[model samples]
Target: MFGPRHPLMLIAVLLIAAAPAPHRPRRIVSLNLCADHFLIPLADRGQIAALTRFARDPEISAEAARAAHYPVSRGTAEELLALRPDLVITSPWRRAAIAELLRGRGVAIADVPDAQDYAGIRANIATVAALVGHPDRGTALIARMDAQLDALGPARGHGRTAAYWQRRGFLTGAGTLVDDLLRRAGLANLATRLGRPALSRLSLEELVANPPDFLFAEAGPVRDQGTELLTHPAVLRAVPPRRRLHIPGALIACATPAYPRAVANIAAQLLAADRIPTRARSQ
Candidate 1:
């Protein structure tokens, strides 16, 4: 122990003990749509330097409104490098050129995975949160998602068949993210029963002939019947109006924390359809 008379020794020991740890990233930049969604809920607004332009479009991003407060980028190397973010988040699958360019210039970058199931979603949320110095926030968000799912009870997957029919006769197939969500919500995907591929074409005739318990039509009205197959006259006539529930592009477009909300939305729609009187539904 240093004696009171030895002031120099005591001062040196105190300075060494109180030395601060290195600082973490203060500014983060996202170069992909999924990465933007991950950053929005996990990082503080101040931590975010810029999000991709998709973050501003509600049609593709579930966090459009939340992202409005932050500056957005188009993933240009020059613009991204200008921000000098402490950490850069992106998807190697997307914006590959930009990701490569930034990395070549010695910028810190992390790739966000493309999640196809609940497990993937949780892993992604946790990954992003930890990188942003908010692992607990990720845990809390996941817990909330779990609580929401638990509240839904285990009675879902009543074996009721559903279809995520999109534009141009495109149907969401089995072993896909939407399919997984459908099963979680207690509904079976029609694509599996139909034995369709990932991008199968379901003609209006087949859709009408084998109508599922529910018909999930894509968002928007029939701007052009030739292109917008969901609005085909046969589909409109065969699928009962009450049986249809249009899902916005934003909900199923990404596998983010908002995913639980999508599940709940579908469940709510199913419940609403069930509530309709059989006679009126058939009319």
Candidate 2:
């Protein structure tokens, strides 16, 4: 091995070792569900001052189980200020007023982008990891996610199509995270055929007239008109109960490093759906 030729080169190395690491925020708070996903994996527990109240909501937050171990916030600016966090992370599209107010008070606020695809997802992970002073962890997490996604294979549904049917018949459209997940599972989104926008309402009559090969809906009941829509005689007659897949919103609803789990879950459902004999299923 070759050594530093000059004594000054060795002196430079010594100075670098003696230098202190850059400052990292100690009290971190996640103001939203998606923000909790980033902070949970990237920060030390001691560093996490608080998380959003929804962190424990199994219906939405992906890290609900993990979030249970940390202190949860009430989502009010007053409660967040009580935590005395150096940083508050939330979605830019949501709570803009809170974000601005917090900034006015000299708190550093970072917004998690609503990542629609793998590239956006990767950028989001890297962004949060760097904020938490563990950029390397982000890199490793992405690599793991990529490997899992690769093993999951692509959307292999052939001509089979599906839709992420939500409350009030709100369909998640193309270019959204849910659509990307459906594609990764080898399923085409029915939203495309309907010419729906990023998010649009579809009447029961319309849905019944042009049903998809499958429907991706939440496992829990909404106890509202959405429930009525799901159980509607026309909808049942068209798609039937067997074609409905109950993928929880937590597995989706936001961009997280655990995205591969969503993709794998959907892919498994499609594979299982294929097993039903069409002749028998029609009746």
Candidate 3:
């Protein structure tokens, strides 16, 4: 029972007025391809202001088709400022300088690291979902992902060794998202077996000299000299086409909503490749 002019009531009014206003970002910008993965799936389409230039590239982004509807940012501080984004998602690994500049300007930003495994993917999804003010969406996404993984059942590889061979003689190794994917499929990575680093090159001769039980390469035509090496005569002789598993480049580029697709594709392709004639699969 206090009067309106009571000092205690006056203090309460002042406190309420001084409290920061609650806000949910309506204009979001993604500064890296990795951020684009989360922003596209979790945020409302209208909430998106701009995405990275690579967002619509099917060669690397699984959400390329959906991303086409959104505008893209050049990633420069000026361009980002012009968009007047309320929340900017960035990968400090890719554009640290730009993030720093934006921070100095008092812009709200969130740093999303590149996910390296299933756990990392879950963490990133949760981070983006909460940032977009949809924590429930994040939970739903993770639940869907868990269900998809559970449907994959146990690993079927039977400890067979497989190499994720790429253009330019590059080999994906352990301590990476691909390595975790390989493990989930019950296949041992050739790079892990050979004690190779996360990323290393092997000459055609070296690859043939100690080839894995299966070679996994990107599907599509030979578009350049680098890709041409994947179809060289020696490579074909070392590992026949039947033993060469092909996966789309988009599926394995990152651990986003597309990750479950990548897992299913690999599992399906490996099962099919396993049915090849023994003679044809032999080195």
Highest lDDT, which number? 3
Better of 1 and 3 by lDDT: 3
- Cα lDDT for residue 259, candidate 2: 88
The candidate, 1 or 2, that scores higher on lDDT is 1
1-283 per-residue lDDT for model 2 (tens digits): 3466678877889999998774578998887688788888878789899888898888888898998899997878688778888888877775578666677667788888788887888899999888887787888888888888878665657767898887778888998988887777767789988788879988888888888988876566548876667777787788877788867688777878768888788777777877879875664
lDDT of 1 by residue, 123-216 (tens): 9998888888888889999999999888876644489888988777778887678888888888888999999976688888899898887788
Q: Ranking by lDDT, best first? A: 3, 1, 2
Kindly list the per-residue Cα lDDT of model 3 for residues 113-132, writing each as its tens digit. Answer: 87889999999999889898
Off by over 4 Å in 2: 1-22, 93-96, 99-106, 220-222
Worst 10 residues of 2 by lDDT: 217-226
List RMSD in Å for every model shown: 5.9, 3.0, 6.5
TM-score for every candidate vs. truth? 0.86, 0.87, 0.86
Q: Between candidates 2 and 3, which one is better according to lDDT? A: 3
Clashing pairs for predicted structure model 1, backbone only: 156-186, 157-186
| Of candidates 3 and 2, the better by TM-score | 2
Model 2 root-mean-square deviation: 3.0
How many clashing pairs in candidate 2? 2
